[model samples]
Target: MVVGDASLDIDTLVIGAGPGGYVAAIRAAQLGQSVLVVDKEYVGGVCLNVGCIPSKALISAAHQYETVKHASSIGIDAGEVKVDFGKVQAFKESVVKKLTGGVSSLLKANKVQFFQGEVMFINENEARVFNEQEAPRYKFKNCIIATGSRPIELKAFPFGGRILSSTGALALQEVPKSLVVIGGGYIGIELGQMFSKFGTQVTVIEGTNSILPGFDTDMSSLVAKKLKAQGVNVVTGAQAKSAEQTDKDVTVTYTVGDKEEKVTADYLLVTVGRRPNTDGELGLDLINIKMTDRGLIEIDDQCRTSVPHIYAIGDIVPGPALAHKASYEGKVAAEAIAGLPSKIDYKVIPLVCFSDPECASVGYTESEAKEKGYNVKVGKFPFSANGRALSLQSTDGFVKIVSDADTGLVLGAQVAGAEASNLIAELGLAIEMGATVEDIALTIHAHPTLGEITMEAAEVALGHPIHTFVK
Candidate 1:
């Protein structure tokens, strides 16, 4: 990385060293290309730094706390659980440090040079990288723009002292006595549930009639029921009108139907959604690259932009803004640069929400399979019937399989229960490999395990469920 007038030449330049960018760089370098990856921030991007990794760490801590506090019901007499949030944050940071360090090491091993600075397009073939003290120019044959998105901030509840974004909420030193969460989406629900388990009075305000709006009522209803039992105040069909912040606390005023209501809390958390990082720095207009009206870059199946040499992936491009999705696209873009025929397949991408008991989905839902004009055959098996779930005292949800009625092809699957996050991977593989319900049923799952729920669900689809009687 040299500063001044002369430009260093490279085969590929990847901007925004998040999951997509870093992965793209490594893959490109592996395929015998000179790759230089640059970002305005850290290597592992939002997921490793503040988003997925840290939030899950905190959620795990919260879950452990709740488990110990309520273990008396299971014959364990654990007395008086107290939370040291400072230590919890330390644990989260340690995990982040280890992962980020590992990512840095991986990049180094791949022979991909990294720059911790911002990159702006000099042209379609070139970019200028700069930091506080040094600025360098680079001319590359190709580029991959993988800049990720950031949390959207509302004008009425500006983030700062009392108003918090998802990032701000995760960085809190102490858990508040009370919290008002605006938006009952997965993020809001996950964070709200975490705080609730930590002894915070949580009130979730959502504009939809029910929480987790995009999910099916059958799956989301389990979450809503669990939240109610945890004493989380879920006010659906409401809009967050405004908020007032003081040093001591924040008061949020929202509306339900025609009525106006206000709630005072220690802090206000806004988790509506995220906006892509395509606005200010990258200068996409300079290169005349095409973008959508929603500010997302338009890309083909190979993650190639309008400019053949330039590609885009991750949140900046269309589709769900998930880390794994970005990483998958990253590989495709890198392979395309290497003259390989790699492309993206959205059907097998699994999405998991790390809420209490968890929720996971792969491919289409039952309604989605039907809407897609498939002869949908639905089968569901409750966790209550699973011996492992019963023994673990986590019989709150079910595993559902959606397959084609005639062909018996596994169209999609959903899991809502303990280990749902881990369990969805097998279903994703099933869909990816074009497996049938009978295939899954014939493949033996270990006895009395949670995974048997999936097998039983497949058996239910095959019309011969073992655990539960059918008419």
Candidate 2:
């Protein structure tokens, strides 16, 4: 009991109002806990406000802008297409506003008290929450820490006049005439591609041999091909050294195999990676919460921290820093608090990249399965062979399913084509349900649809493909 502290007692205190924090707060409330959720900024956090939602909105706009310009290939000649960047920003803001407003409404409807302020841990079960005016101490039985992450700022090129972070890039008022992107990871590639589509001369500097290095070479190659077609300069195996900025433009200096090169552009976008927001005035060390050497919070299956009463989720904890994954962990943490036997099952967590042709993966890849000692059977089908893909003029990728060669059990799947983000779901479900190649092949998929490609791929694995001639 929080003795003598009338205003501080609560059933649960959720810090950080991002997807993980807000979802956990709502679920905890649903489970009959009086919850108080606090964020230093807004309710919807980075994903809805500035990261995923806004970025996708801009991506969609850029895609449409790029599509109309080249629609003559598809016999639809939409002439003289121009982008009104003001309107594009307005559209992005409107989307962000709607979602943030909805989250606020849901919090109210669920009776989860939402506070806009910074939360600092004063003790294990207690904290001080305040903004500009007042500082009040809060005592709770259980707390969920979801203090997300921030874009890593490079020491050489700090975020300022010409140097920009992902947040800065997303908030740009006008598209730059030229852009230099450091890091060809998902963030860098996605933003770089978007700008390139917007008629910006984009040059990507990646230390790895390929962009989106986390993905396989085959999948990354397709995006690199698209980028080349779009006139993007991708400098792989390069190390960014430093930056020089002027009011007119900024210049980036990098090295490629000891060869020094410099590129000047209207703006410099540094999307190297994101670091956990574990350090700050938040004072997590005061409570002695266990953390990894990399500054990530250590959590168990139930998302509970070393301090049993407190839990952490999202980018702060170890795992892929995805909003969906964070939201999943949030629910599990809430349910565990409610005395429900909910634990995390990461077997089928799907990964999707909103690139030019869109790539997605679930469970494992071919090499991944093989490395795990499974005799893998790869069922590959190209989107070029899919009727829907051809009709949609987006047949630039393929879907591959990896299965156990011995038992034909679906181990994992990868999609690299149109609507791959949506298509990977079925394969993920197959892995989760322990479905086999025969199961997918036997399931009748509708003709002239992209889904048929999945079924056909399974047939190829089973050595009875109908679309392709098997020698």
CA RMSD of all predictions:
0.9, 1.8
Q: For residues 234-302, could you state the per-residue lDDT of candidate 1 as single tens digits?
A: 999999999988899998999999999999999999999999999997789999989999999999999
List candidate 2 stretches off by more than 4 Å: 1-7
TM-score to native of every candidate shown: 0.99, 0.98
How many clashing residue pairs, candidate 1? 0
- State which candidate has the highest lDDT: 1
TM-score of 1: 0.99
Candidate 1: residue pairs that collide = none
The whole-model C-alpha lDDT of candidate 2 against the native structure comes to: 0.92
Maximum-TM-score candidate: 1
What does the lDDT come to for candidate 1? 0.93
